[model samples]
Target: MDTQNSAGTLYIVATPVGNLEDITFRAVKVLKQVDLIAAEDTRHSKKLLSHYDIKTKLVSCHEHNEANKTHQIIAHLKNGLDIALISDAGTPSISDPGYKLVTAVAREMLSIIPIPGCSAAIAGLSVSGLPTDSFLFLGFLPKKQQKQKQALEAITNQSATLIFYESPRRIKALIDNMRTILGDRKACLAREITKLHEEYIRGNLSDILKALEEKEVIKGECSLFVQGQLEQKTIDEEQLEKIIISRLATTELGTSDLARQISKEFKVSKKQVYDTILKSNQIDS
Candidate 1:
């Protein structure tokens, strides 16, 4: 391959997340033909390249050196050098570092092509036995408890399945927090994806937490898929009014505060609770 002749095109390649066989035929061919290959972790990618007998030159392109490497990659592209960007696993720039380089190259009107293939997040979710029509891919949660809690709360009422990437160390804490905010909703913890030890733990949030607690320590990377809300049975307006009025009577809090708490507890709108409170007050008056 002539390095000088192959300049200008940037190939964003998707490598196998776990199983080497998951790689696409086109991805392998592009990787082989590119002048240079930029990777998240060269050593990790080396194994994949070695498996496929790909001899393309590898360069380090990851979160740490992304800003610095972006210029170098663009320089290669400007000079008509074709380059391939790959992550340690899965697709580049999907919660990875290829974004900065891709964005920079695109601004210069350079050709960038995607060689799509395996992605653990999407692969796991596809087989998760959860809602697939709509989903929110929250790549990774904050490490801090409060931030994670706030993050989970922000999406608690979403009607779509929530997909998240989690580290083995923080997965327990993540599950614990989900239980606190999202109740005991069903979730799937898919780990060691597509590998020999691949596993998926499917159950309510509490059960998954307990299972993790019993294990010595989880080893593989994880992708969590949480089921969304199911249809709710309609409660009679009068019955709901009675329940709210009676609960408010036993509490000393103001009507608005009481209504807010009831709304959250019952998964009903605050306005509905407020209207019930007003009706109760009118009847008493």
Candidate 2:
């Protein structure tokens, strides 16, 4: 209710990730009352709007056009047209569109409202059944496998639980890679979150990999959570071997990125990580 002024407000509304009924009453009310709704996918959001009988006008605000659309939205707001910003699902700007628009609006001294609700990351973490004392939300790994491994290698020795968003197509590969890099840590894969076909597979990386292998073809987006390395404050030589072997198996980086990352992580020189890889006899010199 931050729209007490005549200047239009920008409401960052959170819609359901999967279940339509998961939306809050306040969100529904704002969506119905807003002058305009800047949606990530106007076509996809139409279903939700129609379902709720909200007749507010919608404008596309996806990644490809967010910059241009931000100015248009601001013009409307300045003209005293309250606008609601929403993504196809969940809250906007959480690995989705809406950041630029929010920043632009903030500079204009506009009232930017937040209507928080369900998020796939939080939903997956709450039931991950792992130690959630501290966690990291890695939105998505790099598309390049080596870059992804490099990113993983950087945090392999961290003490916080790791959460990642992965698509179904690459779910198997991600597990295989994680199994190699993170060792056999406890993990959970939450699929089709908040939907009818939602499923949670809880176990170690190997267990989940085997379970996924048994499937014909997995469906839906997945939220993977991995327990952190806590018991061993420091990585032992044996643990380093496992880490090296795993990265070699899944990464295309050969030894460069891995070497640089592990060297920095373990407080050693690049030569050390390179020497470890050479000893593993996996990569050529």
Candidate 3:
């Protein structure tokens, strides 16, 4: 509890991602006492505050308005008004927009307190059943397929569990790209975290993809946790063929050109794709 004496303080509060019960006692008290709340989404914050019967003034402080709002928030703080900043879900600035405001406030010698609580990223990793000692948090992959694949390829060699947030619409495509870039590594797809419909699909990329296909439609926010590289069998012909097909769908390249491209992307052999393409063509014919 770092509250400035005679000056207003900035409280960086963490709200529940799914389960409301996950909120901490100190967080609730600070929210109630704060003169103003700078939230990523005021309407969303209102619901949380109403749930606890705590009515406090809330102002929008998201990525879109953070730059403009930071000055206003600081002005209020200088006038001795204590403010609390929170995100729509989880801790502010984890994957949200509180960093700028925090930095601005600190530069002015104002106290900033962090009221930590539930975070879906940590929640998923804690029970992911994967290696957790060293992990990297990749907030979200690029929307473009090629860029996303390139990003995944860059981190494929890291010996740490990789955690990422993904939307349901792109989850399948992401998993497909991951399978291409990272091979059939052990992974878990945790969704509807902390809620009643919470589910964790654990296995290699292929198995998880099959499980997702069986579902009518995947729902909720998703956190994808992937195990790092280890001593495993090399990527087989079938996997190479799948990557070739995926790239072909998204890019215009001949079988020979595609084979070379996939080989370079996954650090595999062009012969592997050439042979797999030959086998695939035989099956199709």
- Which candidate leads in lDDT? 3
C-alpha RMSD by candidate, in order = 6.1, 4.7, 4.9
Q: Cα lDDT for residue 193, model 1?
A: 95
lDDT of each: 0.85, 0.85, 0.86
lDDT of 2 by residue, 113-216 (tens): 89999799888899989877799989889888999988988887788999998899998888877755665678999999989899999998878988989999
lDDT for position 229 in model 2: 71
Query: For candidate 3, which ten residues in a row score worst on lDDT?
Result: 244-253
The runs of at least 3 residues in candidate 3 whose Cα sits more than 4 Å from the true structure, single-residue gaps closed, are 1-5, 231-285
Q: Model 1: residues >4 Å from true position, as ranges?
A: 1-7, 231-265, 268-285
> lDDT at 258 for candidate 3?
62
What ranking emerges by TM-score with the best candidate at the front? 3, 2, 1
Q: Can you write out model 3's per-residue Cα lDDT over 147-219, one digit (the tens) per residue?
A: 9977987886787999999999999989987776676779999999988999999998878988999999989
Clashing pairs in 2: none
Candidate 2, position 194, lDDT: 86
Task: For residues 1-285, write the lDDT of model 1, one tens digit per residue.
Answer: 222344579899999888899998899899999999999999999999999999999999999999999998888887888899999889999888888888888787788888988888889888888888999899998888888878987886787998999999899989877765665679999999989999999998778888889999798899999987555535678878888778767655578766765665467787998888988889888
